[model samples]
Every structure is written in C-alpha cells, then in structure tokens.
Target: MTTALRILLLDDDPFMLELMTDMLQGMGYENVRAESDARRALAALPEFGPDLLICDLSMPDMDGIEFLRAAAEAHFDGSVVLLSGMDSGILRAAETLAMAQGLSILGACSKPVPRTDLADMLARAWQQREARARPPAHGGVK
Candidate 1:
C-alpha cells in the first residue's frame, strides 16, 4: 500500500536526484519522479499529485524556500521532507517557514540522508495519510 504512494524528488544536482531515486526504489517505492528544476517540478505537481515530496534546499534556480512558497500558492497538500547540505539552523528555518505556510512538512535532514531515516519519514507520511483517510469516531454524546 505504501509502495503505491506517489513521490516527487526535487534537487538541482543530477547526482543527488539519481541517488534519491535509487534510494526510494530500493525502499520499495516505485511511484517516484525526479526533477532537477524547481519550476519544472511545480509545473508537474498538478499532474503528478504526489503523496510525498523530498526536496533539496540549495538549487541554482528557485531554491527550496522559493519552491515552498510557490507550492503553497499552488495549494500542494502532500507531505514534505527537506533534504539539504546546509547547516541545521537553515533546515530548521525552512521547516518552520513551511509549517507557517501550511505545508505538511514531515521533517528535514542533512544531505547524505541515511536509508533508515528516509524509511522512517516515509512511514510517518503513510501513517499520516491513513489517519486523514479514516472516518472520525463519534462518542455517544448525541
């Protein structure tokens, strides 16, 4: 079930994009798309309608921050995991900004993200999606 969750990976470095794609597929997630440009990623959002987004902070064109804003404007509802080589402080700031913009941020991690960590994040995202899909319980208050 989790394997069917659509995922989008956005990073400027071609190597990082390839690595992340391989990592996701290795984890049994085959519904994944890799984009090297933020603008192109944004354009693909509507059609892709990803369930999760894994993105990098630093990019030559349209950094992750800007991409977040644009995504918010586009009303993207998928969970986000920020992967960057930047320091912790910057990652924290980006996470906070993303939350403020109403984006569902799963978490942030430094570059060279471990496979276990990525798996954990993906599990969390799947759990969240399941929770959202569940019908609310009604107490015997009526």
Candidate 2:
C-alpha cells in the first residue's frame, strides 16, 4: 500500500508462492518476486533489494530461522513476515529469535496466511521503512 515497494516472497510450497504472488499483484504491487527455493531466495536477496521479505519457516532447503540468520549477517534491514502451519508457540519463538538476531521481524502468522493480516503486515512494514528514510526535524533555537 505504499509506493510500489519491491517485495520478495519465499516459500517451499509452490502453490503458496503463486498464491502470494497473485495476491500481491492483485493488490497493485508491480515488483513482487517469488522464490520457491530458500537458497535461491538468499541469492536473489542482494539483487532484488526488496523492501520486505515474506518467508515460510519450514522449508527443506533452509529453515526460516537459518535464513533470518543469514539475512542478519547480510544486514537485511527490511522487515520479515514469517509464515508457518506449525504450532503458534514455535512460530512465536521463531519471531522472537529473529528479532533478537536483529532482523525486522514483522509478525508471524499461520498458513494459509490470512489475506487481511498479510495486507496489514505489508502496510505496517512500509510505514516503518518510510519513517526510517525520512530525516528528523528540529525546532529552531531561540
């Protein structure tokens, strides 16, 4: 919802990847990219320069936490939305761990991801990104 931000969607499930891509396109996002392989997703990260990453936690290639660690090492400052069908507790732990690793963990949600929740998450991430880009203002000294 904020200025055609480049977004990357990574999930081992091809169906989920397609669904999320279509949804993003339907929402008027023109620069959305989907990666079914987590390894490829990592490779694409630098070149894609995405403003956000929506990734699945339980992938065969690389788990979400591992990916988040790599992202952290790579200094990926963009917000991350972790998706999973696992127990809420596990998801919460991943969210907490990702945050501790210094990746902007947005909010973890159970799959199939709720469209409304996804939309809200993206908007919130975009707002934070925009805020970070803006220079702070100061009052004139007397």
Best by lDDT: 1
Q: What lDDT does each candidate get?
A: 0.92, 0.88
- Give the range where candidate 2 is weakest over 10 consecutive residues by summed lDDT: 133-142
RMSD to truth, every model: 2.9, 3.4
Model 2 lDDT tens row, 1-142:
4657889999999999988988888877778899988788899889998889998999886888898899889889898999999999999999999999988888999998888898898898888789767776564332
- Model 1 lDDT tens row, 1-142: 7898889999999999999999999889999999999999999899998889998999986999999999999999889999899999999999999999999999999998999999999999898778666677773331
Instruction: Compare the candidates by TM-score and give the number of the best one.
Output: 1
List runs of model 1 lying over 4 Å from the truth: 135-142
Model 2 — TM-score against the truth? 0.91
TM-score of each: 0.93, 0.91
